[model samples]
Target: MSDLVTLGQRIRHFRTAAGLTLDQLGDRVGVAGSQLSLMENGRREPRVTLLTSIATELGVTLAELLDTTPPTPRAALEIELERAQRSPHYTGLGLPVVRAGRSMPDDVLESLVGLHRALLERERQAIATPEEARRANTAQRLHMRTLDNYLPDIEELAQQVVRESGHTSGALTHREVGLMAQKLGFELVYVNDLPHSARSVTDLDNGRIYLPPASIPGGHGLRSMALQAIAHRLLGHEVPTSYAEFLRQRLEINYFAAACLMPREQSVAFLSQAKADRNIAVEDFRDAFGVTHEAAALRFTNLATSHLDLTVHFLRVGNDGAVYKAYENDGLRLPVDVTGSTEGQLVCRKWSSRAAFARTNRTTEYYQYTDTPEGTFWESTQIGTSASDEFSITVGVPFADSKWFRGRDTANRHRSTCPDPSCCKRPDGDLAGRWRGKVWTSAKLHAHILSPLPSGTFPGVDDLELYRFLETHAADTEG
Candidate 1:
C-alpha cells in the first residue's frame, strides 16, 4: 500500500479506538467531517499539517501514527521497484519508469526486479577504484591458489584442441599455431593502430583477429597472444555476460593458452626431468617452451605440487616495490595488507623480490636465500617489462626443495622480519630513535586510479558499438 493509504488507515484505527466519530475527530483537528471521511476511505491524501494536528488530537505522536515499522518483504520489493524506476542509472538504460497504481504482471514484475538488482550490482562494480580492483585481483588470486592454480576441465579442453589440430606431443610453434587457427577458420590481421590497453582484438563476425604489427614477427609474446585468442575461439567461451564472468573466462582462456604453449604431458616431463637433475631453472623451461619467464613461472605453479610434489610461490613485483601479482601454496607466509591482500602491498626490502630491483644488470637473473619466521626459501628473480612498468618476476621454493635448484647456494642471504618489527632486519632502537619524526612521504594522486571500468555489454567495448554489432548479428542469424 502507498504511504498515504497506510496513513489514512492508521488515522481511522486510532480515531475509532479513541471513541471519536469522524466529526468529533475533525472538530478536534480543525478538519470537516467529509474531508476527514475521504482521507479515511483513501480517496484523499492528508497534508503534513493536518496529519500532525490529527496525531495530536488523537493523543499520539506523529511518528506513532505514521507506522514506522519495517515494511513486509512484498511491500519492500514494491518500494525498491519504485525507487529503481526513478533512479538515473535505471532510466538511462532506456527502460520505462513504473509509476504508482499501475498493475504489473507477476512475472514481469519479477523480471524487472531482477534487472534492477543486476544493474545496481553492475553500477557498484563499475565505480570501483584501482585500489578496489587490486583487492579484487588479490581475492581472485587467492581463489585460484585455493584451486591449486589449475583447472583440469580447461586443460582437458586445450589438450583436445591440440590433438584435433594434429599438433600433438610438444610445445607449439607460431607457424603451427597459425595453421591451427586456419583449421578453426580464423584469420590473423596485423594492424598498425590498436588500442594501447589491448594487445589483441577478435572480431567474431568477420572471423578475424587483430594484433599489433610489432607482435607479428613470431616471438614468444606474439605466439602467446595469438594462442590465447585462438584458445578463446576453440574453447567456445562466450562473450562475458558480467564482470565476474569476464574474469573467470579470461582466466580460463589464459590457462588454455598456457596449455597450448606448454602441453601438460610435455610440461610435466620437462619439470620431472629438471627435478631429477636437481637443477630447476625458469630460463631453461622458458627456452624449452619458447615462452616468457613470467609464463614459465606461472606454468610451474600449475604443475609444481601436482606433478613435481613441490609447493612453490611466485611473485611479480614492480620497480617501486608494489606487488603486481602473487601466489603461494608453500608454507612461507607472504607479506599482506590489512585486508589480507598480497597484491599492491609494499614488498619488504629484505625479500628477494624487492632486492632483485637493486641489481645493476637488468639482463642477469638475481638469486637470494631468505630466512623468515615461516621458513627458509630460495628465490630466483629476473627483470621483465610489462605494458607500462618494469617488474621482477620471482619464483621461490621451500628450503627443503631448494637443493634441487641451481640458485640454492646463493650467498645473498637476508633475515626478513616482514609483517613484524623488532627483528634483526629492523634495527631495534637505532633508526627508530634517530628518524622518529624526520621522514614522511607525500601522497600523490593519479586521476586514472578512479576511472570507471569501460562501459558496454562487454567490460571494455563501447556500448553503442556492442548494440550495433548485436543488432547486425541478430539480423544475420534471423536471415
Candidate 2:
C-alpha cells in the first residue's frame, strides 16, 4: 500500500487512542467522514493541508504519520494479504479477492501470506535445466568471441589487486593471498568442515573467507579459488537470478583469477620476448607463473589475440573424450549436438586431445599437427588429473602461427574429417560389418547429461547448512 494508507492508519490509531469517532475527527480536522474513510482504505490521496491538519488533530508529528510501516501487526497482515491477492499468480487462479476484515483471525491471514510466500519461493527455486544452461553458455561464448575472450577492465583490476598484495615477481604466495584478503577487510580461514555444497564460503557478516587447506588438489588450485572468491566482491556480484547472470559471474571470476596469476603487463612482456626468440612454450609459461599447465595454456588464450597478434583454440576434454570446455578464435570446427553447445560433445579420436591419451609416455606435453577440413593446425595437449577424472588440456593455433611455438617440429601428424561418421565415429567398414550382429554390448550412459542443476542460492549449495555453519562460527567468534 501507499504512504496515504499508513498515514490514515496512523491517524486512525491516534484518534481511537484518544477515543474520538471519525465524524468527530472530521469536525476537528475540517474533513468529511467519507473522505477520511477513503484515505484510510488507501484508495485516495490526501492533500498536504489535510495531512497537516490530520497530524495536528492526532497530536503526532508529520514524520510519525508518514512512517511507511503499517501501524500495527494486524495492519501489516492486512497489507500483505491485499498485495498477495493483487499478484498475477493469485489473480490468475480466478479466486475471489480475500478481504481481510476486522473479524478475520490473524492466524488465517498469516497462513494465507505464508502460502503466497511458499509459491514465490518455489518459482525462485526452479533451477535451470541443462538445455537452458547450454543456451546461456552458448550465448556467453559467442559474446566472449566478440571481444576475443579478453576483458581489459578486469585485467586492469587484477593488476591493481596483485600490486596491492605486494607481489612484484614470481608466483603469488598463499601469504600474499591472505594479505590480499586482509586488504579487502576479510581474513582467510582454513577449515575442514565447510559445507559440502561450498568450495569456499565468504562470511561477509564476520569478515572471513572459509576455504579448504592449501592441499586443494588439481589444476584449479587453492590460490585460484581464493582469488576467484575475492573477485566476486571486487566485481560487485550479487546472487544471480538467471542462468545467464550466473554464467557471466563465473566467467568474470575466472578471468580475474587468471589475470591475477598472470598479470597482463608482465605476461605480455614475457610472451613478446618469447615470440621474438621463436621458442614460446607452455611449460616455460607455467614455470614462470608457478601455475598448472592447463592454467598457463588457458591464460595464453586470454592474451594471444589481444597482445600477440595470434588466434588460438583451447579444449579440456575428459578421458571419455567428451569436451568439457572449448574456445577458439582460429576457425577450428568442433563437433556440436542439436543444441549448438560444444560441451559434452565427443572429440574426434584422431585429434591430438584424444590421441594424447593413448600415448605410453604421459610424463610430458604431447604435440601434434592435425589436418582438418578447416585447415592445418598444430596442437599441444597435456594431461591433468582431477578428483573426478583425467582430462586433456589442448592449446592449438593454425599451421602458420605454429612456427613461433616450441613444439612445432614434433612430427606427430593427424587428419580429421569430423562431422563425418567415417572419420572417427565409426569403425572400418569390414570390422563393422563383421561385428554388427554378433556384438550386443551395452552402452555406458553419462548420467549428468539428463540431470538438472541443483537448486539453491548458488547451484547445489544447501542454504540452511550454510547459515547454520555461519551461526556456529559467529558464536565461536563471540565467545
Candidate 3:
C-alpha cells in the first residue's frame, strides 16, 4: 500500500464514528454538506482554518484529524486500490475501474490488490539474469560518469543531518551517528548472530536497527553499517523490485554514508587546499577523515571532477589482475566484456593497478606513471588484504593534471600497449617455443558464474531468519 498521508480517510472515519451525517457535521462547521462530502472524498483539500473548526466540532485536535494512518485496514486497502487504479499500469489496460464503495467485499478488494501487486512485480523484469546485473551496473556507471559521480541532493540531506546533530569537524563520532539515527526515529542495537546472509537488519516495526557486534573482515566499520541502514529510510527507498533499483540504492547509500562522514563542504575545502599545494593525495584524505583508504579514494572521485575541475579515474582490482570496480572519464581505457561490464575482466598486467600487487613492500602506497596508448597517466595505489584475497585501490589523473598530486614525480614508470598481445599477454619467444601446445590446465570456476541473485524481496537476505529475529526482539520488548 502507498504511504501517502490520507487526511480525507481519517476525517471520514472520525465523522462517521462520531454519529454525524455530512449535513450535520457541515452545519456545525459552517460549511455546505456538498463541500464536506468533497473534502472527505479527497476531491477538495480543506483549508487549515476550516480543519480546525471541523476538529473542534468533532471533539478532536487538528493533529489527530491530520494523522497519516488510515482510520481502518479497510480504509488502507481502499486507498491502495484507488492508487493502483490511477497508476499507468491499470490505465494501460483500458478497462473501466470499478469504484470501491462501502458495499465492496474485503476478499474482492484483497484479490484486486494482490493482482495489482503482481503486475507491478512483473513490470520490474525480474532482474535475475546475468545480463541484467551487468546491464544495470553499466547503466549506473554511465550515469555516474555523466554527473561526475556527485549527488548534491544527497549531500544537502547529509549536511542537514550533520547540522542538526551538532557535528562540526573531525571524524564523525559514533555518538554523533547515534544522534543522527535518533533524529531519524531509529535506535541502533548491536547484536550477535545476524544471519550469515545479512550484514544488518532493520526492524521498522520496533524502530530498531540490528547490527552484528565486532566488525566483519573486509566489511566496513560499525558507523558505516549504521549510516547505510539509516540511509535506506532517509532516502525514502522502497523494497527494490529490480536489480537496477537494488544496485542504484546500494550506490546511493554508499555515497550518502561517505558524504555524512566527510561532508561535501569541508571535504571540498580540504581538497582545494591540497590541490593548491600541489600535494593532493588519498592517504592524507583518509587520515583527515579517519576513513578506510578505499573509502577515501572513492570519496575523492565523488568530489574530484565536480568540485575541483579535475578529471580522474578510480579502480579496484584484484591481485590476480581482475577488474572489480572502476570509474574513468580521463581517457584510461579499461577492459570490458560485451555487456560494457568491467567487473571480472582483466586489467593489463603492466598497468599500475596490477603492478602494485607484485610489489615487495605492501605497506606504502605504490606510485607509478604509465604511458598508455591513449596518453600518459599517473596513479597512486594501495594494496590491502581481505579474507578473500589481496586487492588494490587506485586513483589516477592525466599527466598534465598530475602536477597537482603528491606522487607526480615518482621514479617508477611503465610503458604499455594494452589490448595488443605483445605488450603483456604474449609469452616470450623462448618460452612460447618450449611450451607451445604442451600445457593443459583446468580452470577453477567462481560461484557467481552459475548462481543468480539470492531469491527474496530483498536480495541476499534470508526472510525466515529476518522474521524470527524480529519476532524474538518483539517478544523481548513486550516482556
Top candidate, metric TM-score:
3
The TM-scores, one per candidate, come to 0.69, 0.77, 0.82
Weakest 10 consecutive residues of candidate 3 by summed lDDT: 444-453
Question: Against the unseen true structure, what C-alpha lDDT does each candidate score?
Answer: 0.76, 0.86, 0.86
Worst 10-residue lDDT window for candidate 2 reads 444-453
Q: Against the hidden true structure, what lDDT does model 1 obtain?
A: 0.76
**Could you tell me which 10 consecutive residues in candidate 1 have the lowest summed lDDT?**
68-77
Tens digit of lDDT per residue, candidate 3, span 1-479? 24332777888888988999999999998989999887776678889999999898888999999888888999988888878787766898999987778898999999988998888767554555677777888899989999898899999998898878898988888888889899878998888867788888888888888888744553347888888999999999988767888899999999999998998989999999999999899999998987899999999999999999999999998877877789998889888888888877888888899999889999888999999999999999999887788999999999999999998889999999988879999999999999999999987554443356766678767778878878888886688
Question: Residue by residue across 147-263, what tens digits does model 1's lDDT show?
Answer: 788888888887776777777655587677777778778877666655544667777776767676744443777777888888778777765644455667778777888888888
What would the C-alpha RMSD of candidate 1 be, to one decimal place?
16.0
Alpha carbon lDDT at 242, candidate 2: 62
Candidate 1 TM-score versus the reference: 0.69
Where is model 1 more than 4 Å wrong at Cα? 1-135, 168-171, 214-218, 422-441, 444-452, 461-479
